[model samples]
Target chain A: MLSFSEENYLKAIYHIEQLQTEGASTNTVAKKMQTKASSVTDMLQKLADKRLVVYKKYQGALLSAKGKKIAASVIRKHRLWETFLVNKLNFSWDEVHDIAEQLEHIKSEKLIDSLDAFLEFPRVDPHGDPIPDKDGNMTKQKKVMLSTLKENQQSKLVTIKDSSDNFLRYLDKKQIAIGNTIKVIAIEPFDKSIQVQIEGREFMITEEVAENLLVEIPSLTLPKVKRTN
Target chain B: MLSFSEENYLKAIYHIEQLQTEGASTNTVAKKMQTKASSVTDMLQKLADKRLVVYKKYQGALLSAKGKKIAASVIRKHRLWETFLVNKLNFSWDEVHDIAEQLEHIKSEKLIDSLDAFLEFPRVDPHGDPIPDKDGNMTKQKKVMLSTLKENQQSKLVTIKDSSDNFLRYLDKKQIAIGNTIKVIAIEPFDKSIQVQIEGREFMITEEVAENLLVEIPSLTLPKVKRTN
Candidate 1:
């Protein structure tokens, strides 16, 4: 089994790789992990030796299949735990992250499976992030930034790009939550702040905050055509 | 915050101190941790430096007040998690221990407090071990070994002195559970094996098994005679 730190490295690299085409650079990973680049290089080399990552001297590193699997498993555990804390334990979304981080490292398939069952197999965490299934599969939802929505167009909150505690608390203060319907009322040309309607209340959010909120437009499904045989 | 390994050491030392009046010896801690004596000594010294324990030259170590509080908190977390697994997730008692071991190290006062509330403040875990309160207080139940009960005496199973998987599985096979009413029907004079009645089923159990089963004979609540005021 990998150490907790090793598992953390793999998870960091996986997220970095998702945003870029090339392998995750040591500096990028260090920035994400809030650690020294030199330390990242050392860890990359160790992971390479373990065949968990493909590390090139100057080009950075990428997770091997084995490493990716482990990383996804950790993420799965984390999202599921977060869901449990919020849905079952009455914890708010902003407060579940740190606790879930520790729970993600618990190594027990049976325990996690049992928890999944108890939580009724949630598809998304309280943050609206899609949870990875047992086989390391995540259902990618088609979502766009809230700021990108046209004026008068409505969408549902799918997930948020930023799950930082500050951002989450800000959202909470606005009474925003996953699955809430949001509509763009207008945008300020000077500062790019958007006036939006959530549930019947209208509010203005800064461009940065709007950009962090991912929203999905509802599909217009006409009545199914019935053909006579 | 203490590392998971450090917390484990404190818990082990705490258990050892309970069994013996003196401080825990390095050899005993080593046996509990399944590590080398030298490593235990090194860890003990580190703990001493942190003021979590008092370590002597060769005489072993004892937890300080701060250390004891931390140990009790960890125990509280462990037993609470075990209770959650069994009560909420439908996990068998024998399957909850290892999972709880990992969960006990999670660092979050709010999360644990929420869990305690969700579980309705259970007094004892599924294994019949009492859970420590938030203030590090444990209620010591009046209990004795089943083997010590005389013939024709009836008692209730309170807890198990041994929790090894083998022993728990054996108990499961025999349909034994905590809080079951056990009656000592007879005892073999030659071998010290006792015939026990549990839930209308009569069976023979060896003295070794009986010794591990802690039981309590209920005190009769006699009716008080009314007196003139």
Candidate 2:
């Protein structure tokens, strides 16, 4: 029965810890939460008192097992709602994030479970982020950045590291999305930008965008030819 | 922009005003919100400052036009979510209320609008409560209590005045639901219990239950005659 603010703090700490490996510093949590460092320190103390986090005065804070479970559940709800918004409600990927943020706070195990069943248990959200299962188990996919692919190599867009509305809109404008097969045509040596062909359309994407787009390399299997051919 | 507490207070005030047909007294609001009278007074003052309610010392409070609009929108969200839970999620009517209560506080206009459309613009929720349109307009259906129908009269259950879980579960046990056609067979004078046939099954329900069940009378029409062989 955590407060919404408490849940949000735990989620922020979990995400920061994922990137930092070590415990998350108060300043890092503050930056992630867009709050003052002093306020974050106060909240960290509260969370520590609740045994949801282990905090050292100046070292950093890390989520306890309890806190990680809560954070995973929150993320699970968020991704599931995003899937529902896009697939059922016909909302575009770029528009579902903010709405899903609010919906993710709805606290009902039954509701979330039923929604998962209704959505056919989606493995990933519209942004290609993995959705944690009911028991908080997430299946992490192995993916490589689009920018790392070799020229003439074929791959399928699988996920996006950056799900900002602007970035999603840009991807939409380029007619790119999850599961679209793309081939790296060439790369500019000066800027490292890549030229790729996706769904019969050729486009050049900047290095920054290419770096954020995750793709799955297709297995190298030779095409079978018909006897008539 | 209203906090969850503020929205809750407004909803309580709106419901109390509907019953009292006057300004909602602090005591009434406290009773509805399960809070102290002092707390209700404090919140009413805050709402007054925001110009959402018109308040006076010990005189009670009434929602301003803006407050009414916000209240209506919250109600709309609650009903829409309830509809989704029951219809889309396959939750029973008795189980959807608390979930909908949490879902109603989600603060995205587009989300609610999309849900309304996704539910195919349902006019009433599973409980027979009217769902307010995006503009805060509600379509009021004309209905009568089941107790008002005479013996041998045919009608369809439309809504329930009481939405408590116990009451809904009772209805479920009796296999009664919205849109079920019921025909009153007889009334017991001693206890005022009525015997009714629902979907070919006969059952006796107390007058109290009947009073809370709203039903719609079908327009009179002659039965079609069969041609002679």
Candidate 3:
């Protein structure tokens, strides 16, 4: 019977913990939520009182197992809904996030489970992020930034770290999509930009863009000499 | 953008006006909402300030044009989501209401429109209530209570005035459904209970049940005298 606001706060803390792996500090939660630090502290105390989170004096707020379960469930619902909007409703990737954000708060395990069955159990969302299972279990597939690829190193685009509409729109304009084969052909040492070939098409992507594109590299790491001016 | 509570109040007011045809009184609204009369008064004033409702002295609250539009839109979303839940997700009629209640508050015209298209532009919800169009227009289909039908008269079941899960379960148990041809074979003079033949199956229903089942009669109503002991 948690309020939507409380669920959102739990989800934010879970995401922050995932990214940092050291749990979320009050200041970091505030920054991520675009709110005041004092307000985040108040929320953290409330969640702690509910046994959803544990507040450490120095380390800030950490999600309890109960909190993690709820967070993962929300994420699961969000990804499933995004998949529905894109695959079933014909919505583009850029337009699904905010709507899914609102939809994730809809309570009812039966509804979400039914939706999961309707979508035939999607493995990943349109953004290529793996969806969590009903028990808060995630199928982990490790990915590294595309810029980390060595010259002549080939990798498969797995996910996008930044799922902003602007980023999705940029990817749409550039024809960069998940499951594409990206091979680094050259590296511009002057600006750290990477020149790559995708599906036999040559292109140069900015360093920022490359950093946002997460990819799975081949087993061998050979950082050979292949830098240009 | 109206809050979900505000949208719900507008919808309540709209329904009250539809049923009474004289708009809603503050007391009736409070009773319907299960809140205090004073709280309802505060909400009415707030709605009046927003120009969504016009509060009449000694009367009640009436929806403005804009308010009616919003209420209809919310209802449209609710009915559409209920259709999706039952039709696509394999949810039973009794199981879809609460989930659809939360989903109706989702704010995305494109999402709802896309869903409408996905559901193949449903004419009515699973409960047989007509779904409002994108512009808040509904096709008028007049219906009267089954209890009002004359003896031996036949009518097509259209909608149920009471859509509670218990009522739906009752209908399911009796195998009664929308579009079924119901013939009032006999009437009890003592309690006013009616015995109807549905799909060649003869069954006796309580007066309260007859009052909740709404239907459309053929042409002219001929009240015949066929009362039983």
Candidate 4:
């Protein structure tokens, strides 16, 4: 319904809004979009007139409900393409983001629906980002920063917030995935880094890395089978 | 690089030019595009000015070499998307054409490149239509109509000249696919209908169906794998 460039603006604005507690600023948006402040201002005014964004001069913009819906739809396409690339095309998680970025702009509802069906309606992409539903509802989860976990507490890696290719490559090298279980074995007092266990193997994670990693506390379940029959 | 409608027009003109000994007529193009002759005339003038078509009123239009290159590029994108849909997306052979038709219009060189890599550089789509290479060079194949096959002679299913969804669905229901070995066991003299055997299963084929089905004499190597003891 909208131009690709306009959709990109909305998606960028939406992401800026998500990162901040309040409204997004014009400077921040310009920085995020790698465009001049004047251009962003011009587009923001247009979006405000369209009721897709709430904008005030010198201040940033927040997406209206309709704007948020469009952003989420674009994100849904992005994540679905990423999942398809990783799962079916044998592309490394790190290698898929740029390609999926372009594919997300392909404007066909039927293509996305068939893709969602073909990918078995995956809830998340390779990066653990939720794939939005058809109605633009995100797959909400009660996840916390890995750094927030207490010492000796165990959890599972559910998602990662960073989309940097280097970070994804690191995850691939670590053999960590969406469903991987992680145990918080110890905390290093000097640097606030932690030692965690995954798949019976242990690795040390820095505070910065842990903060970017999303984790879910496991519910109580049947005891582990030690010394199996 | 162009609108989907424009790319489709270029492809139509390219194919039409390939068919005729000389140039392609406007009426024929109008019929092929399912549009009014007036619309065809309008588009032809536009394409001619763009240097993509050589048009002369009351005669016909021929694709310029540049036009053919653009058409081949579009065909490359179309077949690549088809392979991706059918092979990776689990779309049936009958279900991919429409989706590919839309996907072919996405104007991202990187997306197509990634898709080509994703599909392992398939030489053809599921329908056995040759996918043009990176430089827009299409692999040529000898065409043979099923109606031309002699009784008791064997051949292999190759490409279908007509790729209509209805035709593909019919083939799917009959368990027909590219590279399947077939032998014309008998032909009824009265109506010119033939009986063909595939994988030891015999099927009666009507004259109309035979004319639509394309094959190659003596067949080619079987695509199926033989078990080894």
Which model scores highest in TM-score? 3
A102-145 per-residue lDDT for model 4 (tens digits): 78888778779988998899998887778899999986677888
Per-residue lDDT of B47-151 in model 4, one digit per residue for the tens? Answer: 899999899888778988888899999999999998987887677887778777767887767668878987889998999988998789987777788888877
lDDT, each prediction: 0.91, 0.89, 0.91, 0.84
Q: Indicate whether candidate 2 or candidate 4 has the larger DockQ.
A: 2
lDDT tens readout by residue for model 2, B139-207? 767788899887778788988989899999999999998888988889998999999999899989999
lDDT for position B22 in model 1: 91
lDDT string for model 2 (A2-90, tens) is 88889889989988886668999989999989999999999999999999999989987999988888999999999999999999999
Write the residue-wise lDDT of candidate 1 on A1-229 in tens digits: 8999999999999999887868999899999999999999999999999999999899999889998899999999999999999899888998888888899999999888888999999999998988999999999788889887766778899999999999999988999999999988889999999999999999899999999999985554433447698
Residue B227 of model 1, lDDT score: 69
Off by over 4 Å in 3: A221-229, B221-229
- Listed per model, the TM-scores of chain A against the true chain A are 0.92, 0.90, 0.95, 0.89
User: Which of the two, 1 or 3, has more lDDT?
Assistant: 1
Q: Which CAPRI category fits model 2?
A: medium
Residue pairs that clash (backbone atoms under 3 angstroms), model 4:
none
- TM-score sort, best first: 3, 1, 2, 4
lDDT measured at residue A12 in model 1 versus the true structure, 0 to 100: 95
lDDT (0-100) at residue A107 of candidate 2?
A: 86
Native interface contacts kept by each candidate, as a fraction: 0.96, 0.91, 0.91, 0.17
If the candidates were sorted by their DockQ against the true structure, best first, what order would they fall in?
A: 3, 1, 2, 4
